[model samples]
Target: MKNASRRQVLQGAIASAIIIGFNPAMRSWVTSASAASEFESLPPLDGILYTDSATRNAAADDFGHLVRRYPSAVLKPGSVEDIVRIVRFARSHKLKVAARGQAHSTYGQPLIEAGIVIDMSSLDTIHTMNAEGAEVDAGVLWSQLLLASLERQLTPPVLTDYIELSVGGTLAVGGIGGRSHRYGVQVDNVLSLQVVTGAGNLETCSRSQNRDLFEAVLAGLGQCGIIVRATVRLIPSAQNSRVFLLFYNDLAALTHDQRWLIAQKRFDYVEGQVVPDASGGWRYMLEAASFYTPPDEPDNSSLLAGLSYTQGTQQIEDKSYFDFANRLAPTVAFLKESGVWFYPHPWLDLFVPATAVDRFVGEIVSDLTLADTGQGPVLLYPVPTDRLRLPLFRVPDEAVVFLFAILRTAPPDASAIAKMLADNRTFFERNRDTGGYRYPIDAVPFSQADWRQHFYPVWGRLVSAKRRYDPDNLLTPSQGIF
Candidate 1:
């Protein structure tokens, strides 16, 4: 009894010291104090804490290059225990905390101003793997996990097009990829998650236990808890994949073929995009992949039997499964070398109902010129509605839905940003009229009212969950939902 009482007293004293050191009003005092001394009074852990200008500046912005919110300190937790200690310290001191996993977010969704930013990348450890699934640290990238799984002749069921993204980052935002039609989104493939709640409780939740937290944290937008680790479902890895690129001049024809292919399960992977044509018009490109061994490779005639694509406008290639998944790595390298990779990416991702996809595409693409879209990609693909079951991830009421992504790279000028924002708004309004939902992964400045309207039926559940998990509302303030 005496020892417990002593521990309580010590914890109280430490909490009081942290409150004073982290107080926003005492900014000057903190700056003047020795960086070492300022943090010495807080909890002791194995992680590294950086309060320097350079470290803070690096954590200020994300892929969007729009919002730059300075954090008070950047933390690289050495282990899961270190994360728990840091979150507990922040909870006791009333300091907001946000997790940064590669900072791939195009919006300021992961940025936390005047608070602590927990860098999750330091905890990249793959714990174990088996025939059923793999258990890995949240900071592990999909690419890393894929390689590890491949060694065991297994691979994750769903992977984003860019495998370089962190596992927790993609799961938090409902990771979707070319194979999502067969499996589901990455979140749908998760078996369990280890989360550090706002109250500093390190809890493991799954569908059968702590069900609410599991659902909320899947696409919860980091409002409830920070996912420290996850159990990802895996399947047998294919030896090779055959890729076919089909081109079409008419939008309806392309979509018709996509619908037919997906419904028939004729392809292991399916996706399509719109690009500028040499004749000053837009062209649709349908990409499909079939997994097989060299002996079982499908011929072009059989694969392209009845698609509505122009003859002789097809490119077929046989690539190893690993090579096919990592195909976009070269494109990213070129973008970086060309100096446009770091530009303002006012990207927009939308989910339109299958019934309304035709009208939405025709209207948006017909009104824009090649210059307006810049050199980015106009990604359009179809995904089934029933695959996703998260309430917070709003979707249209249809059997099928289309993911329309306008990944635009804009100049750093204010006027250019304004024009992109206007175009996004125009498309957003059109999507709203057609019963579509904003994917919320890209850059779009939305008000609280707009968010409420976007999440009409689930708004109450979200608020209640936030109250139960993060009662102080101290997590992910940049989302601006609360």
Candidate 2:
């Protein structure tokens, strides 16, 4: 009698939802509630399953503020078991599922329409830390891990420019930063992962154990599994960092110097930027940092000895290691306060072959205007291709590749957003022709063919792994990889 009463209530809710004009996809979920066998009740979960408009609406968009796809429900899992149960339920119901971290992606990569959205933030916990590495929940932010690691005088080998991103989020995509030139991207630094496959199985994978799943899950963009926890590589941390800012008027000169610096490994960190000059032209700035303890400091003369940057235009600063790593916090706060953080960001991130970087970047900069770039920074830096080992983390076929990112902000105007998106498509095509690959974080559009081409020789491996781990094709459908 109780089960029948519950079914009646659910049927009433479905009727109301249909009359309210739910979209087709959403209506399917609502109608499914009327099914006697399947819609009796959701499986027991450790966390809350939210169907309220407020929670569902909040999960509808991401950092891009461009696309919006409302999910039927949001799951704030209290435990890893909650995820397992929900995924199993979703698979049984043939519903799509996606795991969201900070929602920092500039596209709809994490959004799922009329499906289940797993909110990973509720599982924020640092499991353990040792001389070897740190094990943390996927919801734990990079900044949180950094502070905790500092207590033991250890740090992750590589960190993204923005430390506030979630661990599972960044590892899903290859986390790259100035330090990546030496230590490789963040995914390359991971020692192991605890993942829930599409089939709802919890498995621990590493290089020696479950090697295929390990490679596919790292930088796999959540196609095959949801990363629940990770054990990442760490190293001894320095007390302070000495940073050098070298200016260059010539594009070729800047790239040349950046390549030489990474090749010689003179600095612990190397990155470059394209900034607008006072005269409405663009100039290059090479930013490098060297780590040191109090007793010993970096010798500026020795570090900058052979650099071809313009003379007398150099600036230097000293900061604690923590401060240096978290430098973007202030800027992020300012953006939020000024209302710029909510603007639409049609960012374009590409990995261009080192051989074509100078010519490719020079042409783009010459044609760009302040309006097109907005208030965001333009980043260009070289990363050694040989150092990146993960199979799914795609890069240009070369000894070195340049990470060129144009983080553009568009006003809420429809025409402006449309224009920027169109420009992105054009830029992507040109970069693709030049042996470059998209970083998959931007707003650029892609089709199945493009994704296949992006994977190229390893496409078969990716397919096989997906078939093995996510047989039902129920994980991360928003990525459109399959």
Candidate 3:
């Protein structure tokens, strides 16, 4: 029922447009418009389809605040049927299609110049929930989904640090955070998906059914199919959580303690960050969390009695699970209000081998100052390799992989953007030489050759999947892999 050809889906859209009073005179103006007018070739459905300048400009960029790619038209689908119609129409006409969810990408991965941009956010719907899992629309934000699930006394096992991103958006790129070390990436926790392929077929896939699609679509970067809906695994929710913060002046000591802590399974969650040390030196802060009932609060002293931390600098806090998960709300609010949130973010994310992390951090941190990174945090953390099972989400061969990120935000001036990109390039080249794998979500100007190198062993499988599911390369034209 979700699959329909272009001609078969026009009635709903036509009816809606008529009800809203479609402007007949605008047809003449649309025809004379830029190449964006090519959208007129497609049949409509129950959605808002337009090529006006306002909508076009709004869909042109993403969170990076760089790379403007104006799509021919933006389609806000009211139902899955509309997506099927729009994609089928684009495939038939050899036009490109990009499925956009929240536009949180640092690069222009979701933008398609002179092509159709499908706004998936309008399809937001959280259908059902249970102890096992919940079936929800891809456009639903992780924060929104978490709130709804908490109401039912359940929650997703793994959540990114920033939950404002869309489910499909993070799933496509392998969502990672502190919990990932224990539960695995968001993509690994999926149960099933309702994907609309480039060929315009609405296929339901899971681990046991349509197995190839199920594997390919996770972290598939919208190259294989557009994930319209997903069944996410959930866990019993806890009422409260105990949080810990430990500081260290030495990188080796911090990373060593992290490895020991994760191996012993001493905490429910573990991660670390690098901040400017008081005496103009870089310091490491280890963050851990434990869930428990209010009646059975954990002994913070017992938990940290053996760990080595900076003398007399340990901190502990207690918060409800909801408040703990949403602790970053204040930071994000400050960024938004400071006007820096709109600045161009030439971000870089990479996974370095645990063995090489010491040297990697040493080289970068030696020259890195707060000013050099646009005052953004230089986040560094370790993750277990066993949790990441998908071949497409590449990582180092070591037992532990360290995630190092340089999240830089700069003014819109050409010189500022150029300087940030230059710094990013230098950092990336050094990391690549050290056998590190780029996360690909950052603003790296990747070449086809670079992408192949990034996915060497699994490159063939990815290509095969792309051909099988999106033979015409009609999806995610901005990723530049095809």
Candidate 4:
């Protein structure tokens, strides 16, 4: 399916080894200032710098599990001007800059060892919030934004599973959760973006504005520039929401029904997750809910043709809008408080090609059941790829697909982390051979050579965009884009 591997990567080694074009003098200066530390001598910004390991480690980021990215300085920019100044200094000296939002990245991809980290988490100002739209700073968390919107009886059109994540953070990588089936992705709802490019230029991006930067920044994973502000499209808050769970013993049945619902466009939000079975298999937990009607009325009434909405399960809770958005908060908080959150996440997520979904799952179910994965669940859902049905995401073609992932947390111990690292390597190997993969602002151990092959037909476009916005390659070096 995919071309190349860890061993086979050397085939492109010779072409990669030759830097076909370069200005030698400029390149020399770039090398000298690449790790610039003169920020200590520079004027103060609007926020604070956090160098302490424990403080930086405590951040609720996806890649906290990556042990290697302990950065030298963490700057919590308090204002857009602060980000501007920081970018200016970094660009002048060719220093690496990473915009840290929720740090929900599973790999230490967001963390840059011995580099400067602009903690967008400090610019918590909410610029605007109304039925028409809302504008927020980079550091504003989704939770706070929702609460603010509700005060005005307005809510953003689309949001992620974990609202505590910063708007800029999720927008950079195409945020999607249960609601994505209908609204597209968190990025799709974005109306505008205030960005500071790698070269220290501040610009506003939108369809009518700098549209190229806007598209690249959407699900671009902080590669092009730092998103210091975003204008999110909003709709009237749903009055009430009814959440229901459908349990499935069979994976095939689960996927078939899930695909059908996505194609049929029957629900507002739809997703399926898996938990371990006592028999060591997995139980698929699916739910489809909406606020259009009262809570008692069943949400499952032939959303799909064959599957029974319920083998007849009873009604669950009809939650408030805020409650439904944070249904998983308590459990996530419990895990965080218990130190389970610190463990590395050796996660593998992929978009299985429509034609091979059945064969793909069949081959791996046993290994997943037996694998000693840490805490977290295996997430599996079949999503519609028809262009008109789901407009927010960027799929290569109109092909039905499965969004599959193994989510887990690694322990603090070096040995345990190592085990997880190894497991991830093995898992990536298994998937790459299938030519079925894609990553969005996640930890990517896969090499640059391999990554190109992963993108395949779109690889050229991705590379062109990367070179255009990040010519000097100063933004998010931790992602290893160069």
Candidate 5:
């Protein structure tokens, strides 16, 4: 009892010391916020508008488990009106606003200093399934929705690499998963969204309604408006998925098989990742989750004939579709809980056409083999072509190949982390010579000029959209494009 009491007293003393240490600076922050509040009544203001030492501390944080922190204001808007009101305030105050969803980003995308961060967690409400589609508040987690959908034997066609990420979180960026190869991207599955535009107007937009606003918001990256709610398309959930993990020695061989499978629609789900070899080199993780099995029986010779692959057995794991999609939840949670999300993540995702892929991979793999990112699987997946078969989105022509290389920080003795960063740097530099365009990995060394050229013909449409929606470029100041 005495020891427990002593510990409690020590904790209290530490807390009080922290508050005392920042008392002077805390006064200025509170005074500024109070002055801002004085100009007009902003909501109830009862839920606690934090801006002191602790609140200010929350600004420079994320879920990457390993990136350097960038300072930004953390605003927990209690209501939808709060979001609209805050965006307007930020616009008037000449401060940028970034919609922060769970802060799961490994890169500095969520970190914006001297700006307002509109936290979406408070906007949690899952609306019912109606004519338009199911109305889910932007902050709702996908795991919650998956359960509700499964009860009715219905599910959203698309999902993320991990289900713990917020629905709007992944959708804010482009949510890609194994199923994306078949159904389409998470953005493509959305039927409608309730967006709070830059003008502070609450609008419900879809293909049929507010068409321009709808188009801009998809893959919009929280620039045009605050997506307070979304209505996504739904499909019946498959009872079981026959998931198979095939191993391949050669990246080219694995990609070749994957490209063919995706082109011919041979499987319901198709995706691949590269795992480090015994010497820490990377190998292919060719995986698929199909509703049916391959026609060939589970024989050793049949499996041996796989393209340059021999590691994996003809193992088949049967799981419900929902379970399969969220297979990485435990691993994701482990990474987050273990403080691995704090490292700098340089993920280079590119959309390569089928024709260019051969030369693209051939040039890349030959020059620098597999990079040694000491993080999760190095994803190399083929995205569905039907959605963007036309000139709707601006990216490389042909089937989209989503490529990513994560650089995870480790203890000083680990060589894999350093090698990963070095290889990524080399890859980015050589990419200019090889005609590879790294989109989201823009901040590293690529200039805006290269970004424009990379976007090619779609540059006009993108800039036009930005001009139409956010002419002043008040949102996402870090993007630097506007």
Candidate 6:
């Protein structure tokens, strides 16, 4: 008799929810007696839980177009409180949960099968801004923040090459950029964060408060907690930027000049690329930028004084600060129009120790053909190891490390993708043997043991934090870390 009464209550709640705007398509999942019983007891939400096929399909894949995992339900949270409520409900029901922001990960890092996916983009809000920094919701894109900051002649010290990425998304992965040589990665410049732990607790953390959680959540791969809000450090912006494009015929000359440029602080921004030549081979291009205000223009001759780039091939261009920061926007638009953006991207990003970068990259590129690269840019640049602060943003143990990225775009054919993935694995093993570490934004396949090895020395601390913060192990199961 008691069981029958409870069932009546459950059915009544389901009916009431439907009448109050719950998605009718949810019947597919709620039809199960056990699922209906558990969902009926869910707490009231400010947001709507969507089970419509269209919404589910949109959340199923990401930028890479590599992996897809559809969830049973998607929650577009109207408020941070909705996240807390849904997470608590998921914990009690033993449902896996993942937070999706921009869905830019090359792999299905933010995906969960038959679980709840929190559409964090709904929480877009830039709450406050001043000379010091801006406090923004997790879903706020870096491009949005940059525009807002530029209005006051300020900008974040560090920004990813692609500013369309969400702040929370990049912070979770340790955002890197050309300016990283001086200011470090984006996570290092963060002042504080507001996170939702897996146990349904809302906490404020920083270097001085809840230090452990602060460290873990930054570049934590969404394992311990979900970053909802952040206060990122900003600096005064310059009015103009002078960009120099120098060509190099030899790899050693390019890397040597890059090292010298960073060591001497000769440019405000520094990066390099391996570009395919007209002769069906590859050459190097070193892109460096200098920021300045009017009447204080950069002395081009002085900046290029000691460099060994090909003398006759140097090109100089000037752009507004905003234009310089958003240089990739046009290329991205072209990619989308050409339909290349929809292809599978099996990118491989590694941090090779300075000692081994030349040999490592040389061997790999020597045999790399245009088909192997898939008509994408190969980026190679150096960063000082000491500048990286977070423990989880692992790097090779050396004075400097080079960021080697093969941003490959594979054909839709299954065989082509398999070939690229296999190549990535081989390169990853080679990188690992030389004490290099992956940047995690790539599509390299990793197993449980691989993940454990990736987080060595600090693996125990991460495990402890996972136990303490997300005791049920319900957060971000797609990462396969814990």
TM-scores, one per candidate: 0.93, 0.93, 0.92, 0.83, 0.81, 0.93
Using lDDT, give the best candidate's number.
2
Using lDDT as the yardstick, the better of models 2 and 3 is 2
RMSD of each: 5.6, 5.0, 4.6, 10.4, 6.7, 5.7
Between candidates 5 and 6, the one scoring higher on lDDT is 6
Model 3: residues with Cα > 4 Å off, grouped in runs: 1-41
Per-model C-alpha lDDT, please? Answer: 0.84, 0.89, 0.83, 0.67, 0.62, 0.88
For model 4, residues 1-482, the per-residue Cα lDDT tens digits are 02123332333223122111112334321212243422223445444444445544554244555646655455666567777887776666566778888778877667775567887766777887778888998788989988999888788767777788888888876776776666767787888999988777888999889887887777776788889889898888776777767877777777777777777767677877776777767666677767653444544454434664447643556778888887779988898798776667767667676667667765666566434467477777765554212122344343666677777665667786676667666665665566556554444466777655655665666667668777778788766646
> Which residue pairs does candidate 6 place in steric collision?
none
Which residue pairs in candidate 1 have backbone atoms (N, alpha carbon, C) closer than 3 angstroms, thus clashing? none
lDDT of 5 by residue, 136-193 (tens): 9888888878878777777778777667767777666667667777777777888888
Give one digit per residue, the lDDT tens place, for model 1 in 1-482.
Answer: 21124444345334322222343244421422334444324565565556667777899999888889999877777778878888887776678899999898888888999788988888889999999999999899999999999888798988898898888888888999898888878999999999998878899999998989998899888989999999999999888999999999999898889988888889989999998889888999999999887666677677788898998888999898999999999999998999888998888899989899988898888976766667789999888877887777777889888999998888888898889988898888789888988888888878899889888888888888889999888888898999
lDDT of 5 at 264: 70
State residue 87's C-alpha deviation in candidate 3, in Å: 0.6
Count of residue pairs whose backbone atoms collide, per candidate: 0, 0, 0, 11, 13, 0
**Model 6 Cα lDDT, one tens digit per residue, 1-482:** 21124444455346333312212344334522334333344566665666656777889998778999998778778788888988887887778899999998988998888888998887878999999999999999999999999999999999899999998899989999999999989999999999999999999999999999999999999999999999999999999999999999999899999999999989999999999988999899999999999989999899999888889999999999999999999999999999998899999999999999889999998999999889989999999988999989988999899999999999998999999999999999999999999999899999989888888978998999999999999999988887
Cα lDDT of model 1 overall? 0.84
**Model 6: residue 83 alpha-carbon error in angstroms:** 0.7
lDDT of 3 by residue, 163-221 (tens): 88899888888999888888889999999999999889999999899988888888888
Q: What is the lDDT of residue 177 in candidate 4?
A: 75
Q: Candidate 6, 382: how far from true, in Å?
A: 0.6
